[model samples]
Target chain A: MIEVINLRKSFNGQEILHGVNLKVNDGQSLALIGGSGRGKSVLLKHIIGLLKPDSGKILIDNEDISKLRGRKLKRLKERFGMVFQGGALFDSLTVFENIAFPLREKTRMRASQIRKTVSEELAEVGLSGAENKYPAEISGGMKKRVALARCLVMSPEIILFDEPTTGLDPLIGKAIHTMIRSCQKSYKFTSIMVTHEIPDIFSMVDRVAMLYNGVIHAEGTPEEIQTSKDPVIHQFIHGELEGPISIN
Target chain B: MIQILTLLRIIGAFVIFVIRETGRMGIFLAEAIFWIPFPPYLFGRVVRQINFIGVKTTLVILLTGTFTGMVLALQIYFTLSKFGAESRLGPIVALSLIKELGPVICALMVTGRAGSALAAEIGIMRITEQIDALDTMALNPYKYLIIPNLIAGVISLPLLNFIFVFVGVWGGYSVGVGIMGLSSGTYFGNIRDFVTGADILEGLYKSLSFGMLITWISCYKGYFTGYGAEGVSKSTTQAVVLSSVTILIWNYFLTSILVA
Candidate 1:
């Protein structure tokens, strides 16, 4: 389980997150939705200890993440896998090596075992036989698949996805969503995804939280969020220009 | 009075910026040094970087060393002959190459070739979030990305400096003995008499320190790169300029201390 209490973050004297509170129970998938530049990624980074909040307590499995230091923080991080917006695949390594990277660096597995494990992961992501190709040689969608495969290879207890489908085509985006959903079922890890996929994302996630003006504007099941009458939620979900939520 | 106040403010801000950046660099150096002894030692990566920083840089070092030596011999012979001190030409050329020119010139060249590339490569990784990804994966970015380069820099520079000096001495011999009509025996004899072990050691020390400075500045710039393609390019430029300038400035101090 993860809990964020009264979280706040500011950059260059401008506050982006203000006393925001959120929680995700173990084995649940939560989709964080917000307008552009609403600090969705910032919040995700804070939760994963990538960015420290100006004031807040982030509890992961009941331990305060912000208070953890050095080896402890590293140990905490080992339980996490984050899929970045750009896949963040190591450009120098081939697809196989990228997926096998964590295993090679952190584990004592033999070469044959690593190869077997990587092949299985590639097969899971439907990236079979694409092992030798570099990140540049592959399509954006393929890169995301490789990123997901790499993340899953660790079997982390918690998974964070930062705008995973942002730049892909609709079909590819949907395929990625499906893959995440299937992987979540298989891995049973706590999941938080920052995305803008709207109603389509509703089908995959158990809960939806809308962030507005540096706060959680609303939080509920996907169905409740979809049918919400809150003007901010409605305006955001309907993609309206004029509403309680002002556009800059 | 207001104009003076404004000027003071500008100077104060610049001073603070310099102090802050120096402190940051100091902290960066400390952290890099701290991780040096920790294991999961990546020997293969170190070897690869040495190949890039040292072996591949050999030809440029050789070419520059040769020309520099020839130029020095020609100029020194002309000046020395006017004073009837032409016998000193060989020792002067050997001393200059071994004590100063070899380390400084070789370092500047490596800064251009390998140091800039290291900055740019790591800058791209920073902008693209590969470093962050490594952190999330429970891997230390310094261990994987930095320490190897640091080790390579320390290991490669001294060897390359030796090559530069050796090639440069022969280059001076070719000019002094073959072209200037000085006795080969006199040229060789002068170098043997005047060049001490301490001079060679001083050169070694300069190269080793230069290696550390170049990689340290380059890695620091890249590790803290701002945001995009523009950020990467800016970091790369700063890395090269800063490393080269620092090498020259640091060489003066090192030479002063070593000579004393």
Candidate 2:
């Protein structure tokens, strides 16, 4: 389980997150939805110990991870995997090498063993024959799949997806969503996804939380969120621009 | 009073900027040094970087060294000819190339070629969030990226400088002994008489320092590069310019100290 309480963060004296609180139970998938640039990504980074909060507590498995450092932080990170918005594949590495990176760096596995494991994970992510291809050589959707394969190779206990379907076509986004759901069902890792895909992804996740004004404005199951009467939730879900939600 | 205050503010800001950059560079260097001995040592990356920084740059260094030596020989011959001592061209050209021009020119070339490329590559990685990805994966960017290049730079520049000196001396030889009508024996003899082991060692030391400086400045610029394509471009430009300027400035200090 991951829990964030009173998380406050600022950059150059401009606060992006203000006393945000949230929780994800073990083996649960929570989709964090928000308008673009509303500190969704920043909040995710805080959970994973990538960014330290100014004043708050992030309890991962009931241990305070907010102030962890050095090897302790590294150990904490080893339990989580992240799929970045841009795929964030190593531009210099081939897909196989990229997927094989974490294993080679963090484990004692021999090259032959790593190759076999990487091949297996690649197949799991539906990228069986794309191993030798560089990230630049593949389509955006395929790159996202490759990123997923890389993340899955570690078999992390938790996975964070940052705008995984942002740049892909609708069909590709749907395919990625299906992949994530199926992979989660099989792997059973806790997932916290930051996305804007709306009703499309509602069927795929267990719960939905709307982040508004630097805090979670609504939290409930997908059905509960879908039937929400809150004006902000209604405006955001239906893609209505002229509502209580203003772009400032 | 307002103008004076504005001037003072500008000066204060510049000083703060300098101090901030220096502190950042210092911390980066310390981390790079600290992680040098830890496990998961990236031997393949170091070798690849060395090959890229050293082997791929051979032709440019060779051409630059040869032409520089040729020009130096020609000019030195002309200058000595006025005093009827044109035969002294060999020692003058050899000394200058080995002691100063070899390291400085080779470093400048590598700065423009390899240093700028490194900064741009890393800057692109930075903008694309690859560095953050490394952090998420429990990988140290300093160990994985910077250290290999740093090691490669330290190893590559001196070897390149040696090639530069050899090619440059030969360039001087061909011009002085072949085209300029100076006796080959006199030319070779002058070089043998004046050029010492210390001169060679001095070139090596200068090249070593130049390599570290170029790589350090370039990598630092890239690691802390700002956001977006514009940021990467700006970092690359700053990397090359800063490396060149620092190399020249440090070369003067190094020369003065080494000479003393």
Candidate 3:
């Protein structure tokens, strides 16, 4: 379980996340939805200890990950799997090497074992023969899948996805969505995915939370979010350009 | 009074910028030092970087060293002929190549070639969030990305300097004894008699220091690159310019101290 209390972050004296509080129960899939640049990704980065909050408490499994440092922080990070908005695969490394990176770094597994594990993960991600391709040579959707395979190879206790399906076609996005749904069902890792995907992701995730004005404006099941009376939530969910959200 | 105040403000800002960058670099260096002895030392990466920095750069260094020595021999031979001291050209060219030009020019070349690439590569990684990915994987970016390059620079520069000196001395020999009609016996004898072990050691010392400086500046720039393609370009430019300027400045001081 993860608990974030009063998380606040600012860049260049402009506050992005202001006194935001949220929680994710163990083994649950939560969708953090927001308008573009509303700090949803920032919140995910905070959860993974990639970006520290200016003022907040991030309790991961009851331990304050915010206060962890060096070795302690590294240990805390081992619990996390983050798929960045841009696949963020090491451009210098091939798909196989990238997927095997964490395992090689953190464990003493033999070469045969690593190859087997990487092969299995690739098969799971449906990227069996794409192992030798570099990140630049692959398609964007394929890169994201590779990133997912890399993230899953570690078998992290928690997973954070930042706009996973942002740049893909509808068909490819659906494929990625299916992959995520199946993997989540099997791995059952606590997942927090930040996306503005409508209808499709709404059905995939168990719960939806909307962030507005530096705080979670609404939280409930997707049906509850879809039917909320708040004009902001309605406007956002239906992709309307009017209501409380200013286009300026 | 307003002019004075504006000048003071500019000076203050410059001072603060210097302090901030210095502190950041110091902390980065300390982190690299701390993680160097830890497990999973990346020998393969270090070797690869050495090949990139040293072996791949052999032709450029050779060309620069040979041309520089050839020119020095030609000019010095003419100056020496004015005083009927043409044989002295051998010791002058040999000493200059061994004690100064070989290391300084070789370092400058490598800085332009490898240092800029290092900065740009790391800066691209930073912008693409690969550094953050490393952090998420429970890996220290400093240990994984930086230590190998640093070790490679430190090791490769001295070896490159040795090659430069060897090629440069031969260049001077070819030009002075072969091209300029000086007696080969006189040229070889003068160098053998006048040049000492300390001259070669001076070049090694300068190369060692220069290697550390170039890698440090380049890596620091890349590691702290701002954002985007523009940021990567800026960091690469800054790394090359700063490392080159620092090498020249530090060379003057080192020469004064070493020679004194």
Top TM-score model: 1
lDDT of 1 at A190: 95
TM-score of predicted structure 3, chain A? 0.98
What is the lDDT for B66 in model 1? 93
What TM-score goes with each of the models? 0.99, 0.97, 0.97
- The alpha-carbon deviation from the true structure for residue A195 of candidate 1, after best TM-score superposition, in angstroms, is 0.3
> How do the residues A1-248 of candidate 1 rate in per-residue lDDT, one tens digit apiece?
99999999999999999988999999999999999998999999899888888998999988888889878998999999999999999999999999999999999999999999999999999999999999999999999999999999999999999999999999999999999999999999999999999889999999999999999999999999999999999999999999998888
Clashing pairs in 3: none
For residues A1-248, could you state the per-residue lDDT of candidate 2 as single tens digits?
Answer: 99999999999999988888999998899999999989999999999888899999999988878888778888999999999999999988999999999998888899999999999998887889988999899999999999999899899999999999998999999999999999999999999999999898799999999999888899999999999999999999999989999977
Q: By TM-score, highest first, what's the ranking?
A: 1, 3, 2
Q: What fraction of the reference structure's interface contacts does model 3 contain? A: 0.94
Fnat of every candidate, listed in order: 0.81, 0.84, 0.94
- lDDT by residue (tens digit), candidate 2, B80-100: 999999978989998999999
Worst 10 residues of 1 chain A by lDDT: A61-70
In model 1, the fraction of reference contacts reproduced equals 0.81
